[model samples]
Target: MRSQLRPETRIDRCFEALKREGRPAFVTFVTAGDPDYETSKAILLGLPEAGADVIEIGMPFSDPMADGPAVQASSLRALKAGQTMKRTLQLVREFRAKDNLTPIVLMGYYNPIYVYPSEAFLDEARDAGIDGMIIVDVPPEADEELCLPAIQRGLSFIRLATPTTDDKRLPAVLANTSGFVYYVSITGITGAAAPVVSDVRAQVARIKRSTPLPVVVGFGVRTPEQARVIADCADGVVVGSALVETIRTTLGTDGRAGPDTVSAVHRIVHNLAAGLRGAAARV
Candidate 1:
């Protein structure tokens, strides 16, 4: 008998499509409304064309403690430019108006969503075409707070598994994780250090044995070469801080986005996508 068909989401189809192409996905992260709205909109619209398979839009927050310096600065810039949780959803709505295929995942802490009152935000998110979530603060123990509710609403609640996620804890992390598992290559804050390939590979392998979800490694992945190395082992690779830093450095003297800001981020995504492609060709 044929196996039962599983539900397919934009994120699910994205990984499946990349699997057929024999390549790891290149995921891009951008803080919505960083510096300003129009500039951030340009970056979001250009990402897919620039070779991003999936996009993670960060909800600008004040105390982004888990984020490293680069990402924290991005949040501040967005907040300074008047980016609100409501505006963040509008960014996704605007993005959905152009591209219907590339999956968009909202990555952020839980406070903003809690303030939005879980149900209302989830309904708005679904309407805005968000495919998944990467809430760093919500653990399996507290899945009822967000994860379970998100899943019930047909949204993939992607979970993060770190090198410190031992075997005993792996099951809890994977218990309700959907879309794909974001394997943080480092234990500390995001982008603090580079990830060793061997260590990442071993951890990815261990996580896979616990769940069938595609493991995508992130954190400390900055350059295209580093992306290629991580892509060689995992199902996908994520680059955030480096891309955020590009926006941070490219801002004008007055602290607004520069003329080349959008193009600069597109270039970063393009090169990383190329790296993943090159790695896939090798495989």
Candidate 2:
């Protein structure tokens, strides 16, 4: 079945450019307002220059069930620092002012969007320069609530295809999915274990047979070596827990962003991007 068409977003363009360069995209994830707004913004502004091809800014939520400890803690820190839906959008708006080409995807659960009142949230998100969204809680079954509306408004509604997403369930998952298909390399929560390269290669092939959208693998991907191997088989690689952990470790004793917090995260991103560059693109 042919997938529905949506507006050509920054995400599509980013992947097109990466394909021409013969390398997988280095997608980074950081919590919006993590530690604090200023620190988060500084980190956001530097990502493109540090070699991130696509950026996934996590929206701080009280209960991010899909995430592991590192991302959960990042959310708590952001929320403690007064991160809100509006502030998250403001972060994107501010990032857009400096860099316009890198695609930005807001990733998190749906409660915040629901509370921001759905339609209004989509409008503001687009205006704020968000290219797509990864709402873990909203399934393909409930596309009417948010997915359809978001696509209609020009936001790519990215979907996740897990290890368990068998052939039977794969089509529905890809139906409304746009921008790309995020293949969760592991079966469990984020950052739980290392992804088997062979397993990832097989799963990515399976997903590719179903759709033409770029398939990026994530979960349990931490080091540059791991990123390189994963990127070899997928269109892109997403590093969330690893990046969030970098921020956590760089925080001052007072649990705030120290001087090195921003630079440390950017450095890690640079190394990861270098890994992607070194990878042999999948045939």
TM-score of each: 0.97, 0.97
lDDT of 1 by residue, 21-66 (tens): 9999999998999978999999999999999999999998899989
Candidate 1 residue 258 Cα shift, in angstroms, is: 0.7
**Deviating ranges (above 4 Å) for candidate 1:** 1-6
Clashing pairs in 2: none
How many residue pairs clash per model?
0, 0
Q: What is the C-alpha RMSD of each candidate to the true structure, in Å?
A: 1.8, 1.4
What is the clash count of model 2? Answer: 0
Error of 2 at 123 (Å): 0.6
Worst 10 residues of 2 by lDDT: 1-10
